[model samples]
Structures are given as structure tokens and as C-alpha cells.
Target: MSGTRRLFAELAILGGLILVLAALGPFGSYATPLGPRLLHWALYLVTGYAFFRPVIAAGSALARQMGMSRLVAIAVACVLGAFPTNVIFVFAAAGPAWRSVTASDLAGAYLQTLIVGATVTIVQLLAERGAVPASPAPPTPALPDPQPAAAADATEQEVAPALLDQLPPHLRGPILCLENEDHYVRVHTLHGSALVLIRMRDAVAQLEGQGERVHRSWWVARRAVAGAVRQDRNWKLRLIDGREVPVARASVADLRVLGWLGDAPPAA
Candidate 1:
């Protein structure tokens, strides 16, 4: 599906789920009338869609910088993002009720939002991870005359097998990085990315000496690394193609040992 259409579909599904779930009275203890309760939940959904989208984007970027997985990033982002969203909800809906609420009540409200955030994150994660890769294109018809043995030999010698060999031919290019999405691995290249059903270890093995795993769920090509940047206390490798790969804390020494990082990296 197109990115735009997919986004709309996801929003529709999320809205439907929230409405149905709200009917079950997840916020039953709030002590509001039926009309007020319905409006409250409806407003909650609006705030959810508005706030969570940017939070998710920022979280994904932060996760990439922190050498974290997509799932981990979403979970962390939602939990942390609840604090701000809850404040917005109080201002928009509770008003005077919010003013009277104690510190403990505010904390409790954030905790509730955190639970809802986690639930929503899990649903979105499942939808993304369960998606299938597109099928490969059919081969073109062969020419009437067969290729000469010399020509075939030269073609074979020119294209050496690398980790990208597992990807579709269209996606083959200079390796940028690899991302683990649930059970599948996304092989990213200068051209684009493609998903393959392979374990991270096996995929890395196929790369031979070409690339190194920067995190448990991320691998990057040494040649593709253009520079390194430190974000607060974390490190990220900027690729030649403009993509960034996070460097795990445990792997800092490894990068230095591998010459990807100098002996004296600026303290993060």
C-alpha cells in the first residue's frame, strides 16, 4: 500500500479500537455521566492521535540514535510521552477538576495513560511486524541466442555474493545498514531496503568481512559510515547515504577496536 493510504487505514483501525475499548469503561472510575464519559473518551482519542504521532516519530529517531529496536523505541516513547499528553487532557477536559486534583492524582492519571499507551503500542507493533514483503518481479524472456561462456564468466566474477545477495536484485547496492523488524531482517542499501526471512546472525555471516553489528538489532557497513555524532550520552554513526545507525554502549569499544571510532572518542 502507499504510505499515505496505509497511514489513514492505521488511523481508522486505531480509532475504531479505541471507541470499542472505551465502551468497556476503561475510565469508568472517573465519576462522569454517560454523555460526559463518551465525550471524554472521544477527546482522549483525538489527543492520542495528535500527540502520539509526533512522539512516535521522535521516539523512532531517538531509538535509532540509541541503538534500540523499533518495538523498544515505541514502548519507551509512549510511556514517556504520556506525561505531556495527560497535562493537555487535563487542560482541555478536566479544567476545574484538574485544579483540585492532588499530586498523587496527577501521578495516577499519568500511570493510567501509560498503560493505555503500551496497549496501543503493542497493537501497532503487531500490525507492522506482521506485514509481508512484496513478491519479486518475474524474469524477462531470454534472448534467442545464448550468452557466450566468456561473457557469463565475467558477469559471475563481477558480482560477488554479499549480505545483499539475499535481497531482491532491485534492492542490491552499497550496504547502508540492517534493521531487525520482529522475525525478519530489513537489508538497507544505497538504493532502498528489502525484507528477508533470515536471522541476524546468518545475515551478518553472509556479509563476510564487509559490515559489523552495531547493536543487538542493527548492523552497518564500515564503508557506508561517513561520520559519527554524539547525541547527549549516546553515539550514532552517520552513513554515506544519510541514514544514521545507533552505536550501543557495549559496542563502543568494538567500534574503536575496529577503527570505526578513534581511540579517544569525545566522552558522551
Candidate 2:
């Protein structure tokens, strides 16, 4: 589904569930029928509006960094959110109803929520897989032929040394790029990671020849990508050291072209 349509659907579901809970509230005696209905509707609007900002912000950030469709993330979040929300309603009504909320009730509610979430997740995964296009194999770069012994000796070589030496000894190893809350780039390398007082773009430029930007906040060594997994409608690129990077839709094509998504043996 499109992002906007999915968002509207989530809002509708949230509203509907809130209404259902309010109507079924603690023997229906904790509030007048009208009062519960009005309260649910009002809370839906107010809380929904309040949560929308952070939800959108987080979704966008994840989408950019992880490469999953924002719509899928939002839908999953909404489905998972229903249970806690219903529990909140139960707790809120407990005091007024003079009845304690029981473990059984909470357990039952959580089980139901899990079932619903799993169902939604499975359906979305199937839909996304069906929508994936069968793509052509990517082209491999050509290698040059070796020179003869005589020519090799005559050739004046001004070979560039490894860039790894430029960095401190401790900072040399597999690197993970992270975007900080303050919008700065944090580089985690094998020797040790550090938060550079620089923008992500600048960091990327500096690390240009060393690694590729696999995600918005991730610049990984080309050799680091160990495998790929289809999670719901999204793809995650797994690194050799167990780091997982989200593959964005915009980058999917490029990744494929770079042979990142090709049929290859899975990492051990």
C-alpha cells in the first residue's frame, strides 16, 4: 500500500480499536455509554495527533537508514501498538470500576495482540515478495591482462599506499557508520569507534574510497556485506560481524546492479 493510504488505515484501525475497548470497558459500568464513546473518540484524536509527529519522524529515519518501506514500518507499529493501548484503557478504567486488572486479562489481551500482529506481518510479507520484479544479473567489472616480465620492470610505478594508515592504528578495522541524535556521524571501527564532529556527508566523502554508503547512516566496507534477508516487505543486509543494515528502495536497484542482491552462497 502507499504510505499515505497505509497511514490513514492505521489511524482508522487505532480509532476503531479504541472504540471497541471503550465499549467493552470493565462490565461497561466504569463509564456511561456516551461518556466512554466520547472519551475514546477524543483520546483517539488527541493521542493520535500527539504521537503522529514522533511516529513519522522515527519512521522516516528508519526508512532512510534501514531501507524498509515506511508504510510497512508504520503498519507494523500500529498493529503492535494496539495491545499496549488496550491495556492502558483497562488500567485507566480499573480505579473507576473498583476492580483490579488481572494477569489473566493482560495475558489474554497480549496473546490476541501477538496473533493480530503476526497475521498482519505475514500478509504484508507475501504481498511484498509477489511485487518484487525478476531482475537481470548485474555486469561484472573486467580485469586487465598481466604485462610481460620485461615491460613490468620498465614501468615506473607511483603506487598509492593503503589509506588505512592515515587513520590511527586503533581505528582500523571493519567500520560502522551511525548517525547520532545531534545529526553528526559516529564511526565505529575495529580498533575503536569514535563520533566525528562532522556531518554525515563529510564523513562519507572522507571515507569515499574505503567503504560504500550502504544506508543513510551506514557506510560499510564493500567486503563487509555478508548476506541479505527479506524481512516482511523489506530487505536487511547483514555484515560479517552480525551488523544488520537496512536496504532502502531507492538503493535496491543500485545494490542489485552492484551484485549485492544476487543469488550467492549464504554467509556461514
Q: Each prediction's Cα lDDT score?
A: 0.66, 0.51
Candidate 1: worst 10 consecutive residues by lDDT? Answer: 135-144
Q: For every model shown, what is its TM-score relative to the native structure? A: 0.68, 0.38
Best by lDDT: 1
The worst-scoring run of ten residues by lDDT in candidate 2 lies at: 152-161
Candidate 1 residue pairs that clash: none
What lDDT tens digits, residue by residue, belong to model 1 across residues 106-152?
77678766666665565555555555453333332221233654563
Which ranges in model 2 have alpha carbons more than 4 Å from their true place? 1-169, 174-181, 265-268
Top-TM-score candidate index:
1
lDDT (Cα, tens digit) per residue for candidate 2, span 1-268: 5546554655565566556556665433346676756585455334434433244455546556554565666555655455665566456646576366787877655544444444334443334334321122222211123344334223311111133333344454444344432343445543344444466676666556545666655666555566677778677776555657777667777877776666552221
